[model samples]
Target: MKLPPIGSYISTSFIDWPGHVVAVIFTKGCNWRCPFCHNGPLALGVAEELDVGAILDDIERRAAFLDGVVVSGGEPTIHGSLPSLLRRIKGAGLAVKLDTNGSNPSAIGELLNEGLIDAVAMDIKGPWYKYERLTGKAVDVESVKRSVELLKSSSIDVEFRTTYVPHLMDEEDLRMVRRQVEPGRWVIQLVDTRLALDPALVGTASPERARVAEAFPDVPIRG
Candidate 1:
């Protein structure tokens, strides 16, 4: 099976996949444009093309040393060859983790049902009302809800994360997000304004972890 076109690859990363050493593959092209996105190049589909055979060969060589492979985006689910890519990775005796925006529930469902992904990290921008404002695009909030439900019911390790942009989201918005996806792991990620997609947010300060924790006493905050 032919692998999807890759935007970039990290030979080794400890933080991408929790408790595991893995190679990270960044896929090109995103469905939504978030002002706070740090990977504007990838999101805009301006990434360099990589050779799939070489990537697989490298993975095969490092399989003995690596625990898994993380497929992140530009929204990995947007690629049609993602399943094939995951299959190849699994065939190499490595596990697969996918990072998505939860905009494509059908793709996520197919991967989960087929047992192609071992873990998932889905990003929930904010409450339904703020999605369009945060993403800078029209969003299908229903699809995001469906995706959340699917992951919550799945047996795999799933985590829903929201990047807390102080200007775009407030304490009440965070609370609303927590309520919408109750009884699951929710992580609050602090935004890095240096590389924000929107120039206006270039110097915006991120919310302090302690302050966010105080605001969201029930939810977990990640720096």
Candidate 2:
């Protein structure tokens, strides 16, 4: 059987997880086409060479120092066999974190229900009405809703984040997203167009911090 494609890996991280040293695995493929997505290469299903055994070995080498492994994507849940992969990672005795776009509720539910993931960071692309505009595709709004609802009610550690872009992340859209989800760990990140796969996206301005703060007075927002 063909294993899921691995796009890229970060050998070490301080912020991917709160306090743990994490090696982030970027999986190939995504359903949405968010213009501000820096990992456009992965979003387009492009894959570099993958070595699962080498990855596992690297994880093993850092196992003593690292706290967990985060399997993010272009939409990791898009792969039907994600749970099995998570299980393999878990067998190495490291925690796992999943980053998703909230488009695949069923897969996320399985991961959470089966205790395959320790934390989940789901993205709220935009308000329901503007989801298509932000994603550059007609997204399944109901599916996104279901995923958000499931995560909000989940016992697992969960966080909701939005990549802050100038034209994409307007004040009204930000407020709408905040109200949709219950008060919890909400993060609004500034989009860094530099190093983005799409060259046209580079040099575009992100929303100013003051404007973002004005939109979200209490919620923590970062880049």
Candidate 3:
């Protein structure tokens, strides 16, 4: 099977999956254009292809050490051949976690149905009203909602993440997002505007992690 177009990879990560070591794969291409996304290059399809086969081989050799592999993006589900890529990781006896912008519920379902993915990290771009503004695309908010429900319905360990881009949204918007993603783990990521897709957003203020944590209480804030 042909590999997914891999943009870049992290050989190991401790913070990505929390309490587990995993290699992170950043796939090429994304449907949305979040100005605050750190992965702007990968998302905009401006990355050079990596030797995916070699990366997989390395992961295989190091499988005994790594707890899993995280297939992050650019939006992994956008690729039709994603299942085959995950299948390879599973074959090497490694657990797999997928990161997505939550726009493709069907693809998520297909992977879960096949037992290809062990966990999921889906982003909640913003409150319904500001979806298009935050995503910088014509978003089908319903599809994102469907993906949220699909993840919640499954036994999969799911973490719904939201980056608080103060310029695009406020605390009230975050509250609305918090309300939508409750009864599950939700993380509020402080925007790293320096790496934003839009350089214009550099130095855009994001709330302190402690302040955000106090606001959301029990929910974790990441930056």
What is the number of backbone collisions in each predicted candidate, taken in the order shown? 0, 0, 0
> Hey, what RMSD does candidate 3 come out at?
1.0
- Which pairs of residues collide in candidate 1? none
Tell me how far the alpha carbon of residue 156 in candidate 1 is from the true structure, in angstroms, after superposition.
0.4
Model 2 spans with C-alpha error above 4 angstroms: 195-201
* lDDT of candidate 2 over 1-223, digit per residue (tens): 4457888888889889888789999889998888788887889887684786688788887788888999988899889978777887888899999999999999988888899999999999878998987888888899999999999888989999987777656777777888888775788888887855546678887678887788688978787
Return the TM-score for candidate 2, rounded to 2 decimals.
0.93
lDDT of 2 at 111: 87
**Residue-level lDDT tens digits of model 1 in 1-223:** 6567788899999999889999999988999999999999889889887887898899999999999999997888888889999988999999999999999999999999889999999998999988999999988889999999999999999999999999888888988888877888999999999999999999898998888878778776776
Q: What does candidate 1 score in Cα RMSD to the true structure?
A: 1.1
- Model 3 spans with C-alpha error above 4 angstroms: none
Clashing pairs for model 2 are none
Mind sharing the TM-score for model 3? 0.97
Candidate 2 residue 58 C-alpha distance from true site, Å:
1.9
lDDT at residue 120 of model 1 (Cα atoms): 94
* Model 1 ranges with Cα > 4 A deviation: none
List TM-score per model, in order: 0.96, 0.93, 0.97
lDDT of each: 0.91, 0.84, 0.90
Which structure is stronger by lDDT: 1 or 2? Answer: 1
